[model samples]
Target chain A: MTLVGLAARNVLRNKFRAALTVAGVAVAIITFLLLRTVLWAWTAAADYAAKDRVVTRHKVTFIMTLPLSYAQSVRSLPQVKASTFCNWFGGKDPKHDKEFFGSLACDTETGFTVYDDMVVPPDVLDQWKHDAQGAIVGDVIAKKMNWKVGDRVTLQTGIYPKEGDWEFRISGIYQAKSKAVDRSTFIFHWKYLNDNLPANRKDQIGWIVSRVHDPSQAAGVGVAIDKVFDEKEIQTLSQDERAFNASFLASISAVLTAINIISVVILVIMALVLGNTIAMGVRERTNEYGVLKALGFSNKHVVMFIVVEAIVIGVAGGLLGLAIGYPFIEGGLGRFLEENMGSFFPYFKIDPRMSVLAMFLAVALAAAASVIPAISAARLKTVDALKRIA
Target chain B: MDTATEKAPASHRDKAEALVSLRGIVKIYERGGEQLKILDGLDLEIAKGSYEALMGPSGSGKSTLLNLIAGLDRPTAGSIDIGGKRIDQLNESQLARWRADTIGFIFQSYNLMPVLTAVENVELPLLLTKVPSSERRQRAQTALRVVGLEDRMDHFPRQLSGGQEQRVAIARAIVNDPALIVADEPTGDLDRKSADDILGILEQLNRELGKTIVMVTHDPAAAERAKVIRRLDKGQLK
Candidate 1:
């Protein structure tokens, strides 16, 4: 038999311990993949943001508003192909009060044009344009809230307190063509929200989004738009869509950093578990190594036996981890997050590259962990090793 | 060196050349701040094609001498020549290579790889050689047959009786066709019937196959099977 074959057989000498080590490695792999998937999904919005679009918000904070005239000024820019403005409605359905989603009052004329990745059918868009009280919901939110066309829904909000709950008819459901688009949003015309507001709050907009003629020149266009508002009563801060999304992510950078650190800690734990198993196996087989040495095997051969055994356990655990992790993360948890937490984790599926990296790390770290034990076994004197009982 | 070494028949001693020769062997071990000398300056020789047994009580250095002769160990100070090569002067790796090519070892516990089958255990020594896999298997099967264990070739060491395991170990030792076989208490763990059976195989290996052997044993009955017997006491021949 080959030396490798013999070493593989030795792995089964303590079947229970081998199984436990493999299980430990598998659990670590799963935890690592879960943390990595969270980090990937969290940054996905920034990663997939449109390069050609720029957002202009109040310079001080998003809580304040800009005059509706600012939307016209942004549209008048030479580099701006189209522009849209929206105010955060902060509206929640009275029926499902606990469920959270994006609610926005957007300019009907340019909303779909600037945010082109929000796909709505022509018939539905035509119908919504004619109805002042009609609303267009995302397909995800529509399914979540059981809203269908022609259904009247009432929303309550603390920010926009009115005489009664706001009411609107469901006009259409939009599907997202890009991962950056939140699939759980509710959108209605800005004019409807404007006409219902008090005199002090009327004609005020939250933010303006403009699509540039050249994506590469988006940064220059953003500077030009902010320059237009420099002398205005309310100053504006303008950035490209990618930068806007990145700033939002930077706010929670600590959480992401913690997840990354936890991923590394899990890998270290896996290595320690693997290393301990290898050390114990080497200790138990000290006498067998002496027999091998006396039978003419070199020190290198003894090391090979130990390293090969560890490699077998490592690879087995990796395959098993992938087998369980793929479905557990992709099929079950991904679906739940996409349906419920779409605003935060719009795309929650596991990254194929991360899976490959996890498997590679399993084998590499396991071999690395076995280094001390393999060296100790190789350096053992044949006579001294033979003196040990087992 | 006086009368401690008893001479065999002159006819037997004069007919063969020396296959193993040791001069001024000294083995010292440091244990808990004290230097314990296991073997003092000693000299000995074994003729080619000889079957000799080394007998002594515990701590007599019989096993140490056998280990030195087998190249499984190095003497602190000595010149050990086996098959005309100075083994004591060779490095650890070089001695390992030399042992693979020249010496086979049998231990009291059989020392068979519990994970491997009888045939696989026999094939262990040949794995170091450039022999093709098919040839290694054939040689292993033939070795097991010589030990009368062809039917148990696929059995693991744990599945076999103590006597059968020892035979498997013997098959492993002779599988590579080494020039010398050194067995340390080969029959120590076996019953009287099993011990006799093992001794008969050792006799067959020495007589029929003409293999030279040096064995260390505490049992005189086991030593009597050899052609020549030497007694050791306090690390010196008696």
Candidate 2:
């Protein structure tokens, strides 16, 4: 038999211990994969955010509203191709109050033009425009709430208390064409909400989204738009959509950093487990190494044997981790999170690079961890080593 | 006294056609701030194709002598020339290569790798050489056959009795056809029948194959089978 084959056989010398070590490494890899996926899914919105679109919001906070006249000024910019304004409606379906989804009152005419990723039939858009009370829900939310085009639904909002519940008919359902577009939003005309609102809250918009003619000039166009309202009663902060999404991420950067650190910590823990096992194996086989040296094997051969054994264990554990992780994360948890937490994780599938990295780290770290023990074993004095029984 | 001298003793051929020779060998070990001399200024010569036994009481340095002659260790002072090469002057890496090419070792505990089968254990030494795979396997099988263990080639060490394990260890020792074989208490752990069986194999390996054998044993009965028996007391041969 070849030396490598002989070395690999040593891994099975203690079958139960080897199995447990493999399982420990697999568990660590699974944990690492899950943490990495969480970080990837959290920042997915920013990663896929439209490059050519700019968002204008209140300078202080998103909770404050800008005057509706700001939308006309933003649309008139030389770089602006189209613009739309929307306010967070904070509406909840009375039938399913436990479920969460985005609800916005947007300019129906320009909303479909600026956010072209939301694909609706031309007839449905026409129908929604004619009927002021018509509301279009995303396909994901429509399936969840069991609403159809002709069905009428009622919503309740604590922010805008009216004499009675707000009523609307489902005019259409829109499908998302891009990963950045959430598939669970419910949109209705902003004029209907303004018409019913008191005079103090009327004629106000939450934010404006503008699409630029040239994506390279979108940032410059945003600065020019914000300049127009710098001296107005309420100033605006403008940024490209990616930067706007990144601002939201900046608020929770600490949490993301923690996940990243924990992922590396799991790898370190795997190395420790592997190192301990290799050390113990080398200790028990100390006499065997002496025997090998006595039989004309060199110190390098002894070291190679130990390292090859560790690599075999690493390969077994890495394969097992991927076997369990792919189905658990990509198939089950990913679908659930995408449907339930669409705003934060629109696309929750594992990145191919994450899987490759996890496997590579498992093998590399296992090999690296064995270096100390292997060297120690190889460095033992042959005469002294043979004196001991172990 | 020159540790770096690679010259062989000039009177070696005049000393009974010696294949192994030692001149003024001294080995000292320090323990707890005390100097313990395991072997004093000792000199020895073993002829080619001779079966010799080294018998000594406990702490008499018989095993230490065996280690020096086998090239597993160097003398603290003086020279050890085996097969006309000054092994004491060789560095660790060169000694390892020399050991693979010249000396074969059989230990008391039958130190065969448990993970390998009998034939694979026998093939271990040849792995260090340029021997091709097919020839290595053929030579290992031949060695096992020479030791009358052809039927047990596929068995692991755990499956074999103490006698059979010692036989496999013997096969491994002789598989490389080394010029010198050094065995230390080779049958110490076996029963009377197994010990006799191992002794028979050693005698056959020496008389039939013309192999030079140097054995260290406490048993007088085992030493009687050798062509020459030397006793050691206080690190000096008598």
Candidate 3:
């Protein structure tokens, strides 16, 4: 008998239409969340990147490398506290030919030091540094490949095309401490790649990474590093880690932007679905509205009732979407994205804000959807409504 | 003879002093650039708790006049005073507020919200008032009990018979305890048995509860039950 109870009951007047409207809203919210998740994960790398770390890449192309001696000049900068380099190994496991993971050649000792967020066990780091032909893999990658700590694995180099299969002993496994770090990379000593390289590729580093003494001076250090090699035959583009991650993200900018737009479109569609359902219900209940008016209900009261009904339906749909979306994403999509695109998305979970916003949007859109119908229903002439056959 | 010609509820005459007075009320409807006059300077008055029937042919403006008295429609040009206050001058929102406080309405078709149970439908009018929901439900139940529908209070409209539905509608009308009750063809869609039952309920409400009943109906049997019957032709009472 309460207004809220009556409003809630009114949503079930046409069970099928109401159910369809709720389903439409649920689908919209789910799609919106999915797309928003994509957009969030795509930019997460840049957002979580370290401001104190600087990256040095070729000014013309990332494919080109800088002289290993460039590390000396980078370390000499007053702002640079620690400096190292990591060359993209571009190595693939011969057994699992299609599974994509990062392979990097890094300074055995200083590489992990500069990027200390990546955690490796003490024994593993010591063992990795001791062996020349040794590599450390991520725990996730090791579990997938089922490689033991001491297993000898051979990987084929796609870029270099080694004369024979490049073999390495699995010296250790590392784990990521944050979402920003990829959990499927294989990092080996730079000396291992450099010692076996041809003369043309010898003593060259893919990109120099530096940790700054102060985050405020990071931009200055980056400028100084680029300036040091700006006039040389090989120029450098030095930036903080965030900008370095952004360049790679720029490759899939179109997909990310499209997803953003589609997320908005789903919300718009949800609004439309809500509006249509409310309009239809109001039209069907015109006579009932007229009866209410005759019984002394103010126009405001009538409108409130209609809007409350719409909002009740909206809440139902929002709760339904939340109930379904969480399990669908975490159980189904999360595992798929984590296993397949670990580099881009370490975890595919819905943001708390997205769920909160969905609830807000549901209520807001429901009220908005009822605006026209409520107004028109409230405007019904009492006599005219009475005269209605129904 | 009384100054108002004694057209008042017989039992409540002292309190029934011409609650609704309409002088020269006219209503014109414009449809697609064509103007149609529904009411033409109709003048009438009814005292409180009067059980009066308005009988007329189609397009006779009986419903229009009732709508004006109930503050549900505006007069094209006239003065309408209900309960000693001029109501025709009120805006739509003001009229709505006034109607909620003073008027109860019943229709030929039981225009109950089908989604609501009979008690919920009865409780609807109290939403316009300041009554709390629990009190509203109690009042609605009392109203349904008065109409002998207490047992059916929890049933939806579809589950009730035509007469029961009409009784539920009447319960809803009186739930607000409004001074005036306006019924437009209250039993127009009912069968003989249902119509008789509805008519009996209205009679009881008028005689026992002293509710003001102003009904517009073409049914002679329904008109006969009214204490006073007014005939309308060409938008004028005759």
- Chain B alone: TM-score in each candidate? 0.96, 0.93, 0.92
What is the Cα-based lDDT of residue A38 in candidate 3?
78
Which portions of model 1 miss their true places by more than 4 Å?
B1-9
lDDT of 1 by residue, B1-238 (tens): 2423434677777788999999999998889999989889878888888898999899989999998999988899989999999998888899889999999888999999888999999999999999999999999999999999989999998899999999999999999999999999999999999999999999999999989999999998999999888887787777
Q: State the lDDT of candidate 3 residue by residue for B95-182, as single tens digits.
A: 8788878888887777888888899888887876778868988999999999999799889899998889999989988888888899
Q: Model 1: per-residue lDDT, tens digit, A1-390?
A: 788999888889999999999998899899999999999999988989999999999999878999999999999989999999999999999889889888999999889988889999989999999999899998888998899999999998888889998999999999999988889999999999999999999999999999999999999999999999899888999999999988899999999999999999999999998999999999999999998898888999999999999999989899889999999998999888888888898888888999999999999999999989999998999999998898
**Which of candidates 1 and 2 is the stronger one according to TM-score?**
1
What's the C-alpha lDDT at position A146 in model 1? Answer: 92
* Local accuracy by lDDT, each model: 0.92, 0.90, 0.84
lDDT of 3 by residue, A44-111 (tens): 77877888999999999999989888988898988888988989988888899888888999998798
Candidate 2 residue lDDT tens string, A11-71? 9999999999999889998889988998988887888889999999999998799999999
Which of the two, 1 or 3, has more DockQ? Answer: 1
| TM-scores, each model vs. reference | 0.97, 0.94, 0.95
User: How much of the real interface does each model capture, measured as fnat?
Assistant: 0.82, 0.61, 0.91
Model 3 vs. true fold: TM: 0.95
Per-residue error (Å), model 1, residue A127: 2.4
